[model samples]
Target: MYTLYYIAGIATIISFVSNKEKTIQGLKVGWKKFSKILGTYLKLLIILSFILLISDQFIINYLGGQAPFVGLILGLIIGSITMMPGFIAYPLAGILVSRGVNYMVVAAFITTLMLVGVATYPVEKEFFGIKATIWRNIAGFLISALIALATGILYGEVLI
Candidate 1:
């Protein structure tokens, strides 16, 4: 769906550039616009990547070498603070798992990261009405708890 939207946007821009009687060529204009947008996103990505790198090292040191419970707490705390897109969250979770973090806790952290965002409450309230947003978040948190429990049980079974 997002890819389709991106393709549609690119097509629209190309058509518009072709129609325009510009001093520069159509391809040049399109490339310039695309490059500007890409550059902006890349800059933001670089900044965020640095923050994540520093944060992971800080968390690992703070939690000690082998502490799954500490990782769970720190992950949840970071998840609550960080508001990057969901796509980034999964890869981060995978990295944490590979580092010997608990899978169930990562699942809970991911759930809470997406579903129980205090930062998004104002925007959600304005769009969906205050009461509706509050109720939905509450329900989402509850479901996230159940998912965490199930994930823990499943993983424990494998360990045993």
Candidate 2:
């Protein structure tokens, strides 16, 4: 993480040296956009944490070995609703798998979390229209489901 910060710092310094005014303007724009995103992301993260903490056992009971398909479905639903960058989402997926969640579930979770945008639907709709947003999400959901199914078959004999 510190390495990434160092690299970004170096890049920023280079950019600033090349064009101070442009670099400053870029930083200002980035900060403004990032601040809004950070607030919403943090709020969603908190809500998700509570949901996970409260339902940990429920998750284990349903999504562990007993009812994996149900677990996968739940994963797709939650993942679609979630809005987080890959850096956070991937680590969360690792933690989930470490906790004994099914591989298929985690696959669906990660895939849909990256591809689907239920939490961003309103924003997307504003830019792309409601119909396009809905279709895009549907496509993402279906693709994630297929990926989960493939993961199950390849990794777990889950579909067998």
Candidate 3:
């Protein structure tokens, strides 16, 4: 992350020197766009923090091998509603697996973690509009479920 900041700083310096006017214009535009979405981003953060606070135990118990279908459903909902980035999501999924959570549930969580984003809907809607965002999320959830089921069947049968 620091390296990325360093690289970006260097690039910005180069761009600014090469064309000061263009660089200034670009920065102004970028800042404007960022400011416009700042409120939405903050709201997302607050909501996610609260959800995580309440969900940790509930998710573990529910997905830790209750009913496979229920686990999958819960996984889909959790994955969709949370905005966990890949770096955190993958390691967390691994921990759940090690703790004996169903593989199907983990798979569903991971799939939707990457594909769906109910929590980020505000940002997505800004770019894609409400109808498109809704459809995309729905499609992503269904596809993630299908992938999870296939993964469970293939891995469970083959490895066992």
Question: Best by lDDT, which number?
Answer: 3
Which candidate number would show the highest TM-score if scored against the true structure? 3
* Candidate 1 lDDT, 1-160, residue by residue in tens: 9999999788867776777555246668778888756654565566556545646555435433435455555555555445567787778777767776677677767887787755566556656888998898788677766676677679882242
Q: Which TM-score value belongs to model 3? A: 0.80
| Per-residue accuracy of model 3 over 27-104 as CA lDDT, tens digit each | 999999999999888977877777567555566776787677788888888877777668988888888998898888
In angstroms, what RMSD does candidate 2 have relative to the true structure? 5.2
lDDT of 2 at 51: 48
Clashing pairs in 2: none
Q: Which regions of candidate 3 deviate over 4 angstroms?
A: 13-20, 54-57, 156-160
Checking candidate 1 for backbone clashes, the offending pairs are none
Number of clashing pairs, model 2? 0
For candidate 3, the per-residue lDDT at 129 reads 95
Question: Candidate 2, TM-score vs. the true structure?
Answer: 0.62
> Candidates 2 and 3: which is better by TM-score?
3
Full candidate order by lDDT, most accurate first? 3, 2, 1
Query: Tens digit of lDDT per residue, candidate 2, span 1-160?
Result: 9999999999999999999999999999999998866765676566656544534355445455647788889888877876677897787777778888878998988899899987676567766899999999999999999999999899964856
- Please identify model 1 stretches exceeding 4 Å from their true place: 1-54, 58-78, 157-160
